[model samples]
Target: MDQVRVAVIGLGMGFSHARTLAAGRIAGGKLSAICDLNPAKQEEAKATLPSDVKIWNDADALIASGEIDAVIIATPHYAHPQVAIKCLSHGLHVLIEKPAGVYTKQVREMNLAAASSGKVFSIMYNQRCNPLYKKLRELIADGELGEIRRMNWIVTNWYRSQSYYDSGGWRATWGGEGGGVLINQSPHQLDLWQWTTGMMPKRIRAFCSFGKYRNIEVEDDVTAYAEYENGATAVFITTTGEAPGTNRYEVTGDRGKIVIEDGKLTFWRLRVPEPEFNQQYTGGFGEPECWKCDVPISGDNPQHSGIIQNFMDAIRQGTPLIAPGEEGIHGLTLSNAMHLSTWTDHWVDLPLDEDLYYELLQERIAQSSSQKTVREVGPVDMSKTFGTY
Candidate 1:
């Protein structure tokens, strides 16, 4: 198969994608073009390219270039759907950076665009590429964990400071980023949560704290509880303001519990209780140990590069995507549900009435007293053209 010519948008995270692709991490693909609004980024990228790469400041021009066969969009959360939809409409396979969209409607539109174009539409859920996670998912799928009862995702190591937020004016505001840790830093965790469990939250109740580090808006701390359809439950906790925080996920099932922390996957093997022991042990003040042991986890690949290569392989071989853009709706919906639950002081039910959520979101956006900030979209006046406020 010929090398798939791909163009990447947004120089921030997209730079790593470009570097990896150019370095041949994607065996059957090459980055033919790069787009960013920043002139210095364009100049720096151009200087770094291997002489034949094309750089453009306009995403539209890059999409219409006809030189690229696919597009990898690493722009902001809100921009992913718009750009990917455009590229898909132009018959380009798309790999969008996650959370997928700032809202559900956008994700639906992007999926429709992908379907109409009949091209690969995937999301950059790189964590799904982690071997530890792959093994964990395998065990869960094989019923190694039995019927999962509860799960907890405590991600605290994603520490962000005021300076991090200040690095880009658009980093923290509701309009710019849609949400904080959930959208920007925790898509990997959120995606993994749903991917491994094969469950979606039917209802969510959340509480959030804003502006602990910077003067910007959006929550830096969030604690949410979710209930699934099968009566299973999960707790998702995150904080961008914590230092040297904890990152741990524990899944408890009837057979055993699986714990993943600091890159180690440990499964506690449950002992089937003997009937004699169950009848005799009640006299004491203690209960029998239900499970024991921790499994050592070892094997990991370049996860981001792996996901990128997977996207390219799908393009070349017509293989099913590891994570489709449509599935992104779940994580995005979960995020919106959490935020909406917190904002409205009510439990947000799943299948989130998108219209109701959108109307509430519009009210929040209108009522938001946060100062506006804009990311430079090249030298063009984005004020009127982009309809960004």
Candidate 2:
């Protein structure tokens, strides 16, 4: 592959995307075009991008102009499907940002479009390429932890202030960004949860707190329970209100527990119990069978860069996507399930009713308190809030 020419949509995050592409982190990719509805943002992009790169106000114009072979859709959550479908219909490969679509039906439509177009359609779930997460999956698959029993994730470090929500009218509204942390910050964790576990939940029940941190109609704090078909259970918690929050995951299997936090993973191995103790401790909690411990993590890890490179490699070698566009529906489903469970006070099963989820969203949209024009929040300084991780 000489060069995988690329265009970017939504100059807010697209500016970052364009910058990364220009960095030439991807061996055979180049920033080729930029598109945004905001002329100011387009100008900002033009200022940053090489003079040869074209800028367009309309996505269709950019797609039709054929200046690039692929597009990176970094638009609002609601715009992902529409923009992806348009790009795919135009015979361009697409790499859409997380939360592939606001709902699964839109994702299905986009998937169908990609299938018909024979183009590589993938979601930007870069977390799946994280070295720690990859090692976690490998350990689980290797049966180092034995049969999986449960997984718990506390991912509240995604702290956001009311000012953050106030930064953009479209940010925390149903008609704009769809959901809150689940859609915005938790997609990466949600993708990691399922990706590392190598399983999907069969059912989910959750309760979400709205208007808890910001004046938003959607959830800012969510606690959801997932039940797997094999009788395994998982608990997921995410919040935007809690400062000095926690980012930790604990996976407990029959043999041991794997804990990951602050980019460090620790494994606690269970020791084998004596035959007499095993017999005497029936129906009770006691010491386990023979055990050992290890932290088998070592390498030159390129998390974000690894994912970007994977995208380029997938495009070049026709390899499978680490996170396929269709897989995004699972994370979306979990997020939607949390809201649905909270709104209706019910448990939601897999293959959620698209009409029902959309209906619930439409109700929230109707009642949404935001009427301000959705402006780009990029120009504002997020440097303080998005501190060094």
Candidate 3:
């Protein structure tokens, strides 16, 4: 494929995006430009980026420059839609950071625009590249696990300290970062939860604990109950305050069960389908036997870089997307349902009420305590956070 020129906005997460898209790392990809509103960040990009990489303080001008064939938007939580819209308007392929937008309504606008742009629109849901998740989805889809009966995840290892929340005025505010962990740290899990299972909850009844673990107004602790259309149920539990937290994802089906944790996957396949065993087994006390095996996952997970490569390939060749930008709304629907359920203290239905969600979200913004428009922390080794992805 021919080389594709790319620019990244927001030096925050863009730091990783730019580095990953560097010319030598991926063939047919070029880190052509970097844009940020902060002049200091632009200067820093100049010092750190490749000499040939252009730096711009104005995103609009960079989008208009005709110098970049595509753009990676790593901007703040709320700016995703607008920035992506700008790129699509200019007929540029876009690879966007997750959470797609603060809400489904905004993401809908972006997705609609992408449809007209005829460009490769992808979201950075890089976890889809992980072999463990890949195998799990394969098993479920192949009916190796029969029909999914239950899904549960306790992804609390996304621990963040008070300083982490205080690092930016926009960190935890309802108006700023949307709704805390669900929007920021957990979009990956939320996306993976829905994607791996290939299921969408028809109903969500969640309990949110706001400021229970942090000093912010948004939720740091969330426990939700979800019921699928097929009568299967799921439980999602997460928090950002726990020390030495756990990351356990388990799925149970009629065939057997699968557990994924600590970078390992285990599958217990039933010798006979549960329905047959239950209906025909003559023994009163005997049940269908299960074969337990450790599902091996070989090769490193490509993660963010994988998504970028796929995006570039989609632009040049007709490759499939790891996570279509339009599908972002499914994960956001789960996140927004969790929040809206907690807000109304009732069940929230699928295809959430866009108007009601937007109205309630505004109430959250009205409660913000700080509105400073500056980043508090400096960039660190993002590899530590992304962790072998």
Candidate 4:
């Protein structure tokens, strides 16, 4: 196909995708259709998008109409894997939004379907498009940081008010969006945490505060400690309730340390590797000399549009995807482990027990008590929310 005709499945966050594709921003893709169950959203799309773009309220009908070559699933958290699986089974390429799914069991099923379908399956990990993170990943992969020793990310800048929660009934509830900050606000960072470092924790111990700052039933504050198999450890702290918050990620290794904060990348390079210096030092008080270097980052962060372009390239020109669908499970695995640790009040191991996780999640869903009146809030301007990582 010269142009991959794409349909976006939801109008909330997917509204931006629809506009970008309709505007011909991505060279190899065309916005053929848009789908949402909300008629108001459909009207909004019809009013803003081009007159020729097809609008449908039924996703199943649009999927079966053979009107599109690919689908971008931007529905709520639980429906991500469900819709992607259906789209893949129909022999269409699929691009799912982040956090994969609420749990790994469902995401595993979706990944298996993608594997068997032989279709281009990807996730909207837009942060991978950020040049700073790309450079960070390159450094870690090229061994510039040597063996990783520790990682700490304080990403509490995702502050949200009560109005934000009251804007949607399905948000911040176990029966709706599963978990809060980890699932919604911090998925990008969680994905970047493992993706940039090329490591997943062997075990995770987390503490989550449900509705501590809002009138919802899901976690809005979290602190998690993770241990890696290589003796490396990590600390992840986040909240949607803190103002004047901080966004900092620091990684320490045998060679030195790297810090990304305030939109700058700084590296402290040791004259010698710490292990080598320790072995050679004759004086007890002497330490390896360190030099501070400012790493220059250049390139525009295309964000969601960049992921869409990559998806199109992968489908039409056989280009590799920036964020493959299967790898999404790694980040979701970390999320599930955190939730499980909080639920069980114990340290959770990796390759999470999918069955037990599912069971516990169901219990939470049954016990959920979210009755906030949802206000009619228009589509959020997502441009303001990207690249803060």
Candidate 5:
């Protein structure tokens, strides 16, 4: 009971989690076990894993074995919720990767079990650990951007080739990963959109281009116009098809504007509120005075390793969770709404109808011709550590 024993399931992207725990980054935790279905992957894990690491072929057996106090679920999109439900049932703390699951209906089920289980449940939303984003969220919450007027995010730097899609049979497929850029590549941005702004879209008119730039069947490009509950309008644009792409997140309000890009947070503060300036000013050709400030960011952006350390801390130290597993539904719901908007060709409402979304997703799955080819995936790249809330 002195050391927190942890097991990471699904060795594809789970490799990073494994390596981090094996490195003894968390003073109270260590990589105790690993689970993967591929024999080839098992062999690959064996060579890199510590001498004391336990290996298992079946995830269900591994969860039920009671060999570890916590398990990080980095499996496929569809299996995320199911495996977490099982692990929580067996009294194991769970840290699941982003998007929770392919659909909200299933993710809701997982959330329900977590609510009843008295276990430490967290999500791998590592982007929340970024100091730049943390500052942005703090500014918005403090109303520095008074009466938020507009928000726009253009994150299109996720260029991927055919081999990347072919790297895994379950990737970018309707029945496999569910949706394309929206589901796979844009979850972090989507989560940050809602998380940083402290608002969810009331309605969304989304346009998603499926396979527009790739040979895959899921969306490669997406543009969405959203209206918040406070009557603020926002636009979100992302793609995996653009090279030398741009990542700009800006929000304009009555008092100030915040722009975050290239690892910097810039602020344009109005000397006078826009409404006050418009009402009191006699000039016809001028605007409010502004002060431009380059916000300085601090703290380490440990990302994936940061989330894992926090997860271990939550269990061992009773510290606060960075991203609770239950909150993941909001971002996934947003992603599903965008896809539903494209499917129905109209504006979709928030708190989306779960049954309707499930039915529509099933129809696409039934019609999809994409086949899944299960094979051994290699190690995780360094860029794979940036997903978050």
Candidate 6:
């Protein structure tokens, strides 16, 4: 195909994707159709999208219509895997929004479907396009920092108001959107944590504060500790209830340390590797000489548009995907481990027990309740809600 036709499924987060595609911002790609069951969302799309663009309420019909070669699944946390599976089964390229799914078992099934279908599968991990992170990953991969010893990210800048939760009935409920901060606002960081460092924790222990600062049924605050097989440790802390919050990620290695904060990347380079310095120095008071350097980040953060272009390029030109759909399970694995740790009051091991996690998640869903009144909200400038890091 010279140009890949694309359809966006959910109008909530998918609306932004639909608008971008409809505007023809992505070369080699055209917005051919949109599907949303909500009449309000459909009308909004009709008003905003071109007249020729098809609109449908049934996703299955859109997939079977053969009007598009690919579908961007932007539905809620649960429907992500379901819709992607259906689209892949129909022999369509699939790109779904973050967190993959509410649980790992379902995400695994979706990944299997993608593998069997042999279709281009990607995830909307827009933050991966951010130059800061791109450079960070490059530096780590190039061994600018030696073997990682510790990682800490305090990304609490995702502050959300009560009305934000009240705007939709599915916002924070376990039965609906799944979990809060970790699943919603912090998936990018969770993904980036392992993506940049090239490591997944061997075990995770987490403490999640359910509705600690909001009137919701899910976790709005969380602090997780993780240990890697290489003896490296990581700490991930996030919340949607703090004002004047901070976004800081620090990674320490034998060579030195790197910090990304305040939109700047800084590296404290050691004259000699710490291990070398420690062994060579006879003076007990002496430490490795450190020089502070401001790392230059020179590239535009194309964000969502970049990912779309990459997806289309992958379909039309056989380019590799920026975020493969199968990798979505890594971040979700960390997330599930956190939730399981909290639910079981114990540290959970890697290669998670998918059945046990599913069982526990079902228990939460069965007992889930939402008492907040829904509020009508206007269009959210989603760009502003992207990662603060």
Predicted candidate 2 versus true structure: per-residue lDDT over 264-317, tens digit per residue: 888887664243456677777657664445576777666555656677778889
Tens-digit per-residue lDDT, 1-389, candidate 5: 46788998888789888998898877788999988877777887799889899988777677788788999998777777877888899999999998788889889989999999999999999999999999999998998888888999999999999899987766788877788998888899989988998889899999999999889989999999999877899999999988989999999999989999998999999999999999999978999999999998989899999899899989988989999999899899899999999999999998888888888887877767556421112222212221111
Cand. 5 Cα-lDDT = 0.86
lDDT of 6 by residue, 262-345 (tens): 999999999999999988899879799999999999989999999999999999999999999999999999989999999999
Give the residue spans of candidate 4 off by over 4 A.
370-389
Writing each residue's lDDT as its tens digit, candidate 4 over 1-389 gives: 79999998888889889899998999899999988877688788889999989988777778788889999888877777877877888899999988798889888989999999999999999999999899999999999999999999999999999999887766788877788999999989999999999999999999999889998888999999999999999999999999999999999999999999999999999989999999999998988899999999999999999999999999999999999999999888998999999999999998889899988888887776544211111233222211100
- Pairs of residues clashing in candidate 2: 271-289, 271-290, 272-289, 272-290, 273-288, 273-289
Q: Judge candidate 6 against the unseen true structure and give its global Cα lDDT, from 0 to 1.
A: 0.87
RMSD of 5: 5.0
Q: Give TM-scores for every candidate, taking all chains together and pairing residue i with residue i.
A: 0.91, 0.90, 0.94, 0.94, 0.94, 0.94
- The lDDT of each candidate is 0.79, 0.78, 0.85, 0.87, 0.86, 0.87
lDDT of candidate 1 over 1-389, digit per residue (tens) = 57899888887888889899888778899989887877777788888876678887777777777899988888766677777777887888899888798878778888888888889888988888787788888898998887888999999898877888877656777767777888888888888898988888889999887776657678889999999887889999998877889999999877778888887888886665333355767676764466555665567666778778889889999877888878898888888888888878999998887777777666655645534422321233321222211
Superposition TM-score, candidate 3 onto the true structure: 0.94
Candidate 3 residues 125-196, lDDT tens each? 999999999999998999899999999999999899999987787788776677788998899999999999
Question: Model 5, which residues run further than 4 Å from truth?
Answer: 373-389
Cα RMSD for candidate 2? 5.5
Candidate 4 matches the true fold with a TM-score of 0.94
Regions of candidate 6 where Cα sits further than 4 Å from its true position: 370-389
CA lDDT for candidate 2: 0.78
lDDT of 6 at 94: 94
Cα RMSD for predicted model 3:
5.2
Global Cα lDDT for candidate 1: 0.79
The order by descending lDDT is 4, 6, 5, 3, 1, 2
Q: On a 0 to 1 TM-score scale, where does candidate 6 land against the true structure?
A: 0.94
Instruction: Give residue 58's lDDT in candidate 6 (0 to 100).
Output: 76
